[model samples]
Target: MAQRILIAEDNDRVAAFVEALLRHEGYTTERTADGIETLQRIGRSVPDLLLLDLRLPRLHGVDLLKKLRKSPVGNDLPVIIVTGVYRGERYARAAQSLGVRHYLEKPFSANALLAAVKDMLPSCVQVDAAPEEGEPFDRHLYQAFSTGFSGTFHFEGKRKATLSFIAGTPVSLRPGFRHRDFGDYLLQNGRISANEYDYYQGAGHFRSDVLVQLGCLRYPELLQEKLAYLTGELLEAFSGPPLKVEQRSFPLSPGLQLFTLNMPSLFHRGYWRSSAPDTANPFPEEVYGQFVAPAAAFYRHVNFLDLNEEERRFVSQLDGSRTMAACLEGASGITPLLRLLKTFGMLVFAHEPLSVEMPAGMPLRLLFNVLEDETGPGGDGPLESFSDLVNEESRDDEPLLPAEPPPVLPEIGDLSLRVRQVFEGMQGKNYYQIFAMEQGKFSFDQLKTHYFKLTREFGPETMMQLAGEEAGMVEDILATVTTAYNTLSDVIKKERYDELLGSEKVGLGQKGDDIFQAQVQFQSGKVFLDMEEWDNAEKALQDACNIAPKNGDYLAHLAWSIYRNPQHGSSPAMREKVRQTLNRALTLDRVPSAYAFKGWILLEGGQDLLAEAEFSKALKLDARNNLARKGLREITEKREQEKKGLFRRMFS
Candidate 1:
């Protein structure tokens, strides 16, 4: 049966083009001009894949996607995002989070669309094709078994395989039963001559070990390459005829070396290769020289060891800035090597450098129009120019005004008095009220929008005219809003806040007590600290300390807050005050926060040894103190790096 695809596009031309292409490729295609009709069709029957356009009538594409993901059928269904206007990182990230695996801007080729469809939906035997031993090898089964299970899979007859896994990801796959040894495997792949393999076999040692002993290979790198080769072979076997598979699990021995393969990327690369053995490079000719290898492939994976002499040199020459064009210039047999490397998920084609020099005094609207016009249907030019515009404006000393002036905020009558009133009654206000949100209904995006507006309207710098008591009140309001945003913006914090709100609603009001008020202020300060609003955190913490003068915990937190404040004057003065405050807190009680803050102060002053000691003391008092643990880890890593440097110098 032919697979079905639903294309949701507003443009009639694009929809017709896509539908014709899919039908030509032996697929049944459905078309809709907007999100509402698409959703209605999907509600009646889910398509095998969804080809969705971002700009749609009745509902936006992203909004429709979010709604689709909530439905039972949409969870695992594939979606290919087709967009023209929506070329922002925020949109891309959102789509990815919603499980959009493929993205194609408007004017995408039929071949590109077909490749994406095949990749997302690999043609395999149905799930019901379990051959008497284990379930069929579908992506779900692959992911499920690989994620956390360690086992040997005994295939039919003389064929069997052993796989080790850590946390549902394949660490390594070792062949079993009728599988060839490393020497034979190497010879079969033409990595070694027949004579070389025979000679290594005669040495009475494993091929890799013998190669290392003879200085023919680096053991670490050669081992990684062997594993990758074996893994690729195993995956190829899985795509063959159905066989009985018996799985057995056993405890993994400690201290064994494991190779971590990004299964998802690896599988995708393998599938693409399988589907299009002779396919040309998907990247444009303009980017041939600009392609760069993923840095993670070097630092994180052992696969970097698999590079041959020329491949190694080529990779080493890629210093992020050097394009493939520049690096592979005049190199022999480079195109084939580049193609092979890309096929194995080793390369990210091109990093477009942003243009910094825009026409001076360009109006924001004209600038946007210029970018949109240049970008065209493919949207590449606009995306790059917009990024460049942002980069240039950020580095510019002068502020560029928007196309239109922002709405003027209503002037505060008796600003000081109003601020003082809000501060006094702040305990009665909830996070929702601070942002002027309707109770019980608001999204994170809504909260963020309102929070920024509130900051601009009543932020500290905007209150330069207010002084004395009024200035202090303005600062307090800023802190309160900052606290609200800090809590409401985070999922965990927001959930906890909602739970607390529910609890408070069911119980008697507790705003009457002084200690409770102080606790609330302290919590608000902690929120600010977490949000990295240093000045606001310091002010709020100081107020908390003032409310409870003898509270050692309050004093210790206040000291740390003051230490982190950039505007707290000279470093020397700040350090001295932090030390004195910590000492006073320690005198009152041996709290871990005091010790941790002391460690921070010591660390900042280049006293690592002393800082380590302070952190140790804090850990002794409270083992769960993260600051103490983090401080110790930093000191240890620094010492290790220093020792490594010393050894390198001595050897040189």
Candidate 2:
């Protein structure tokens, strides 16, 4: 048997990468995202080695290791501690007493990890791996879980269902079976006698809750049974005609998660079991021209076990230019690898990354800083940095400023004459002029390269040195350089800037004043939408509509904003007005949003049939509209429920 290695790490990304590395080395791996699950897994089946992270939920790693040291099974288990915690040497010393033989710091490479595991499990067996990607549905799922990833698995064609995974174990599933309630589940599975179920039904206060409260069944045990039953159902449905399967990496939120059966083990419990499909290239030739990007959560949990030598080489060379063709020169197996990566959703296939609209939109600099603040070192939660900013501003009595005020006064004579000349004259120049480049001439790649070079040569530290002071002046100029890059790099922002610059050159009159005003308001509304400030969005989009009443896009956006704003009560009057606005928008232009929002209104009014029709119309207009697609899904689910209920009534 292949030696099984168990990874106890709360960081999903780190855990996944480690698992992938181990799997490639021919070791079977199981992962737990928290201390509680790790203990349970160890109790159920002992692994050959334990790769542990110190910071874990439910139980701390040092304490858990101490507990394990006292256990018969874990007393002499080979252990390695891998974590990013600062000053973790203190923990290392404590773990050493408990027989943990090795400690690897965060950001360690694959080779180092492989070496450590190999030293501990010298006799581990290796097997030739089956094809891992772009396969039929069942094997794709098996490979995903076996690699120790946790997230939502989506099957987007016939027999669609979305299933949630926690550390390679099935936890929850959506689009649940028809007419399946706790009572039906219990009775059908013979968990409870019919008499017992009838008795519980007579008393009638949530059957499961009552059973637990009365000590007739333990909550944990009951939940486990429930999850097992659901998992069985999901696996059975996995045979739905060769559909497209996509897996996404989800960050495990802080909590004590309930136990779930590992998918591989669950498959062995008699669900549809099958081998992986034949390996033939599924990607089109044009796929090479598309850019591939890592998903948002991929940084934390990346898997490269499936890639071959050539694929590995090509992937390592990805320089943010996702165009596969650009990097595929002389590379073999690159096309199949790209298809696999795209199928697994490890990388996003896009023509280009979407750019933020100008005006009212926060520049990419602020956006990235916000992202870093949330996901960066020591960051605790989503929008953590932005929340801190809001809290700080709320506590202070000062007005919110256009820009962050300088840190403190610094000396001006600190810089050399050349640095001083660059700083003093930087603000007056246009972005292109500041970059010393001509507009419509330089490519984005060229602009990015130039920006990097300039920042490196004349960075903020360089300016501070030249100024001979710690004043915020140098930082201010650095900010300008950053702003210029932001304006020049984004496709939409750069295009708008070019248009404005060209207009200025020709001295165009205010012939399109209304159009300009409407655009400004529309952009503002979009920014509000991005921020989830529905009230502000409504106000801004309302202004846009007022400025250009005939623009169906503006009116449709305004209608959506109004519908989303909680301040506007969902009274009959409000609903009627929203409907009227949507109708007007459709009359002006038959865009998908007008029909989609009209469906939303009708759906809210309990007109399911009408709403379904409207949604269908929207999908006809724009098949890829997610709003319309979701609306149709909801209606279909409701219809399924009614059909199930009718069947139950006739049968029962």
Provide the lowest-lDDT 10-residue window in model 1. Answer: 365-374
Clashing pairs in 1: 146-168, 147-167, 147-168, 148-168, 289-324, 289-325
**What are the per-residue Cα lDDT tens digits for candidate 1 across 2-107?**
5667888877778877876776675656677767768876875677789998657666677688788788977677899987654555556656777887878767
Give the per-residue lDDT of model 2 (tens digit) for 492-543. 9787667756654122346787688779889999899879899889889976
Prediction 1 TM-score vs. true: 0.24
Per-residue error (Å), model 1, residue 466: 63
Alpha-carbon lDDT, every model? 0.60, 0.60
After superposition, candidate 1 runs with Cα above 4 Å error: 1-141, 144-146, 157-159, 166-179, 190-207, 214-216, 252-259, 276-652
Candidates' TM-scores? 0.24, 0.28
Candidate 1 lDDT at 491 equals 83
Q: What value of lDDT does candidate 2 attain over all alpha carbons?
A: 0.60
